[model samples]
Target chain A: MAFLKLESLRKAYGEFVAVKECSLSIGEGEFVCLLGPSGCGKTTTLQMIAGFVEPTEGRIILNGADITRLGPSKRGLGIVFQSYALFPHMTVAANVAFGLEMRAIAKRERRERVAHMLDLVRLDGFADRYPRQLSGGQRQRVALARALVIEPSVLLLDEPMGALDALLREEMQIELRALQKRLGITTIMVTHDQVEAMSLADRVVLLNNGSVEQVAEPFAMYEHPSGRFASTFLGKSNVLAGDVSGASVLVGDQELPADLAGMSGAVDYIIRPEKITFAAAGGLVRGQVTARVFLGDRWLYQLDTPVGPMQVIDTNVGLPKAVEGDAVGLVWAAENARVVARGAAS
Target chain B: MSRTPIALHIFHWLFVLFMVAPLAVVVLVSFTDKGYISFPFDGASLRWFQAIWNQKSFIDSFWLSLALGATAATLAVVLAVPAAMAIAWHRFPARDLALALLMSPLMLPAIVLGIAILRLLSHLGMTGSLAGLVAAHMVVVLPYVLRLVIAAAAGYDHALSQAARSLGASAWAAFRRIELPQLVPGIAGGWIIAFVTSFDELTMSIFVSSAGTTTLPVRMYNYIANTIDPLLAAISTVLIALTLVLMIVLDRLFGLDRILGGKA
Candidate 1:
């Protein structure tokens, strides 16, 4: 049985729906990330699971018990916010001890647990310091320690690294993932950053317009997106709009064979930028280089072809440079492109 | 930046001088040796302060005003914080109307409110009581508390509260652990303003105060009306000092910048 399950959850503000009939099940010790752009209902889904937002419909079950109407405190879930949410008035020790105090734990045990948690976050000596005294990364660690000190059944992180600087964010992401792994806690994190989601999540739940677009492992989702939205959202992809013809797609005068069968009529094909390569002599299609951007290790060439503007990332290994307005040959293996019907873009 | 014109500079200084002149005179006269009010020069002594200390009624009224001001300010915060939170957090159908009603007391004429309270208390047979004075003072102080706290709560990072809730804090726990602490500066600012308003209140106190319940401001008004002496200056000086001390304490606790919403 799954440790936590959300079934047909919906949240609406007036006539605007934030989360619509979303359902997911998380296994014990699973680290799931709800990844989406802002207003995509990722945070709303996390809030609903946390019991802060009452769902307009459906149920939240934990270990097969319905907890749809339970308050946040009764749900036994640990949450870390984007801003850390550490109490400014309290010391680090006090903040970590708050949950224990609320549960009426013994004072000695509370102190012991707080000490242990602070140590776990590498903040042992800073227990007496207030949140204002700590650095941003330290404060975030303290917040994590505070939440985990309670020993909740599930841990939720709402863009927990959003407040940190770029360097600290990367460092904390690694540290947080390690900590979560060490604790063996069932965790759900909401993030807009694709890199964070890809690195941390056991499974990434891609949401678009309040609905699940795809849910899969990071690599699988990147390699095989269910639709145009998922392919473009998870990473950068050059999408070509065309109509399917028998086993091929007609692009102006050029006809390219469709790699996937069952693709009919008007469809969109998603090809990763890196998947396109330069044809040395002759290849699938011919194009003119409209733009070239030097990206350190690789050259990003924007090709203007009959299909449209196609982006290709090429390694700069003594390859002849293609300048702007230069004619070039474009090529891609038929098996690399994933074609989907136009209606699935929504 | 270019220098201001000489004429504008003089006007600005004169405006500032006008504001400080009355307060300066009160402080200066508090140390006067002569029995009557005088300007510029007077033999300086602590005789007026000594005389103020000797007056049993002044001392009693001073303590009474302190008690009343503290009680009313505390009551105002107790009533205002949750009201401000509710107004800041939700957009209920009647929220606007509710906020307007809560703030109406600030615009209402003090004499009118005092009279209304007097009539109500008389009907309830509780006139001339401390309860009556506290009730009236609370009416005047509440809006100031509410306005500051509402501004504070509105400016607070609401995501912080959501984070707390996601971290397994109950609604009450999130409020106590996350939201309430951020509101301290605002609540303190509100408390200071409320206390000052209640302490300096004369028009309202005049209606509610009886022989045994006369506040410091009411007593001071009667004293000044009957006699012009350095003793009244000493009392005024003391009031000014008290206000400054409370403001400084608030500044020390939560920086005066917070009072102005941390702009500077």
Candidate 2:
């Protein structure tokens, strides 16, 4: 059964539509990520769910209750803001105990819960310290503890790790994912970082221009994007203009077999960089490597091919396979290339 | 990090002397042993300071001024907090105009304000009432309170309130727990400034106060008009000490730069 449902949710500011007809059904305990670039309405959609924003039109049903008209305080959802939003004047224990106090829980019970939550977030020793005294990662943990100590039905994270450094961000991401799994609370996170979304979410909902572009598992969305925006936004992709005839796509002079899904005229063939390889002899197409970038784990080669400008990534096992200015044949599996209708936004 | 040049260092000391000369002269005059205001006295005595205790009007007026300042400052702060929050957080129509109206007292000449307030109080039959005096003083001091609180509100992280609400705190609860504590420094600083401004007010208080409700400043003005003595100088010295103590407290509780410089 669907635990939370948003039906045709739309939010408009004057003539600008921030979220246009968004609809989704999330199951219980599912970790969903709203991934998109800035101004893509991912944050707006999350805000609507959290009751911070009221939709211009539509209904929000949570746990079999129509909560579209509910106020944020009445919604009882846990939210971690991008700034962490810890009370600067309050100690860590007092900050975490705030929600419990709001719920009118007994003082003894609130103290016990606050202590347990501090221990859970591994800040047991620093409970008396204020937020300004803690490091960025420690502050982030305190915010999480404050939110989760309420035992809310849904947990919402709005780029909670945005303030942390790259290394701290990764460490917190692992800790957050592990914590979510253990609690089995329905969690929704909004982030522009695709790598973070892919690593943290069970399902990634890609949005563009105030609409959902694609909703799929991380691997499936990356492999089979529905349109041009999704194909490029989730990860880098090489797009080549092509003509479809029968079961093959004709680009330049090479006819490459692609799953066109029947009706097609001018189409775009999308292929991931890692899917393409540097073939030594007699391969799909001939190209010269224009630029080569070593990305630690992979060698990224920018090439001028007969089809168009293309990119290929090869794993860095030992040494360089193809350097800049080298003539190389680019080859990929036929199933790896995807064909989509031309000029489609999503 | 760099040493002051000889010329600039001498200029700084001269500026300090220029500012303190009047107050220093007043203190020196208060210690004179002569009957009148004389530069070179025969000897130093504590008689002028003792004279302040013997004067009933001055003693009563001193307590009245303290009560009036504390009351007016507290009232101004109470009204300014909500006004500052509204002006800082919302985008309602005439927000800037409302803020300007609250702060207009600062721009208006004190004599003009005094005459206008005196006319209103007379028509309302409240010219000599304590409430009338407090209301006039609140108007003078509100701008200082409002400006600091507005600055604090602007720099506050509004997301903290949202986080509280999301964690199931109602609007009132969130304000009490999350918003009020964060604004303490601004409130305390504004109250101190308001109290000092109200205590030193003369033009407006002179217009509003009658014989029964004379404040210490008005009382001193009347006494100086009647006689020339070091007794007034002794009272002035006491006021100077009180102001210094308040300034030190303000600086210790909240950094002077953060409060007066509006650094938030």
Candidate 3:
């Protein structure tokens, strides 16, 4: 058994299901991110583990104990909320010491531990400052320190950096990842940002419409997504609809090579935008550049191909670039294209 | 206090004068040795203050009003905190109706509420009792409780309690530690509002109280009806001073300056 286990956990309100039949296992000290779009039940799933949301079915196990029926306080999971949720009236040190105070820890030890945790989050010398007096990033650090001070079994973060601006958020992500490793506490974070998940998690679980779509390592999830929804949600993709034939798929009167020697039927395939490279001469197919976007480090092109509208991303390292309305050929290794079974969601 | 046109400034001061000049006249008259209300350029004395102080009926009525105000406001807060939190934080069947009913007392006629409470108290065989009076005043002041507490609870992030719980604080502990401190200012504001409303209440108190249980407002109302003396002025002046002291203390505790014009 893993350190923490969720077995077919589910949650429903009236006739509507917010989370349905989710299961996962986490090893000791592993970092996991529940990645999904809004209303995808990721937060609900985390809440169930935190013992805030009652699961409609299944059991949650932690360290050989079944905690499915336990209350949130009994579960002893530390959670950093999306809004940070620091107590406005409490000073930074008091906020960090609250859980210890609740547990009736000795006052002297509690003070020492609070100071230690504050220093860990790089919030030294800010013990007496109230939350309102601190900036956004400072408040977030205080929240993290407060949650971690209790030495919880599992640290649950609900969009921990959602309130920060883009630059601060990116900075905090790297800093938080380093802090988590230093503590070596089991962690699960919920985020809608794919880059955050990819940058932080040892494993990512993608949720959609209250169901688990895919669960894999971040790199595996990006390179080998299990289905169409997972592929499109994780990164930009060009989905091609075609018929499987002998050694190739017939895509819009052109043969796109695939390992379909025995397969014969309609299929959908996903090619990541970055996988398709711009070519000067003949390649897999030709398309007209409908749009071009100059991202800081890369150029992204939207191509109107014979098969469908496709997107190709290229490194902006002085590579040959195509402008909008320019005709270009795109190619990639045959194995880079993936065949995906479509789910009901778009 | 923001900058405004001279005309608007004049209008603002005139409005203040219109509202406060009557109370100012009462204060001025109470300090005079004159037997009746007369204000301009009179010799001042503390004789009326000593007279009201010596009156057993006014003294009893004053203590009765204070006790009633304190109990009613405290009870209103006790009843309203959880109810307001539920109404503010949770979605349930009849939530709108529940809020509407809780807030309806603010709009309902005081005489109607008084009569309703009178009938209820009479039916319960507890008319004119201090306990019955407190209950009635709680009902009267409940709208203030709900309004202030709901506003405070809605502004508060409900997730703080959840975070506290996830940090191993039990429900009551979470409430006492995290939620209560955050609510102190709102509770203080609500208590002051409720106490003031209950202290000045006369529409219901006259109907509910017996001769022994008469409140200051009820006694003062009777005195003004039967006599024309500066004694009424003295009582009003005392109540006004008490209110001013309370407002000053509240301002010190909770910054009423921000309440007045912080937004503008």
DockQ for the candidates, in order: 0.52, 0.88, 0.81
lDDT of candidate model 2 versus the reference = 0.91
Give per-residue lDDT, candidate 2, residue A48: 97
In model 3, which regions exceed 4 Å deviation?
Answer: A260-264, A341-346, B1-3, B39-46, B93-108, B257-264
Q: Report the number of the highest-TM-score candidate.
A: 2
TM-score of candidate 2 chain A against the true chain A: 0.98
Worst 10 residues of 1 chain A by lDDT: A251-260
iRMSD per prediction, in order? 2.4, 0.8, 0.9
Q: Residue by residue across A178-262, what tens digits does model 2's lDDT show? A: 9999999999999999999999999999999999888999999999888788888889999888899788998878988786668
Question: What is the CA-based DockQ of model 3?
Answer: 0.81
lDDT of 3 by residue, A1-346 (tens): 5999999999999899999879999999999999999999999999899888899999999999999999999888888999999888788999999989989999999999999999999999999998999999999999999999999999999998999999999999999999999989999999999999999999999999898888999989998887678888998887888777677777789788765435567777778999888887788899999988889899988889888889899999985488888888889888888765444334
lDDT of 1 at A98: 81
TM-score of B-chain for each predicted structure, in order: 0.91, 0.94, 0.92
Model 1 clash pairs?
A79-B166, A79-B167
True contacts kept of each: 0.55, 0.94, 0.89
Put down candidate 1 lDDT per residue, B1-264, tens digits, no spaces. 998899999999999999999999889979989978887654888898888878999999999999999999999999999999999988789999999998998888989988999999999999999999999999899999999898888878776776566555667878877788788777888887899889999997899999999999899899889998889999888878987897798689767776746221
Q: Estimate the TM-score for candidate 3.
A: 0.93
Top lDDT model:
2
Give TM per candidate: 0.91, 0.97, 0.93
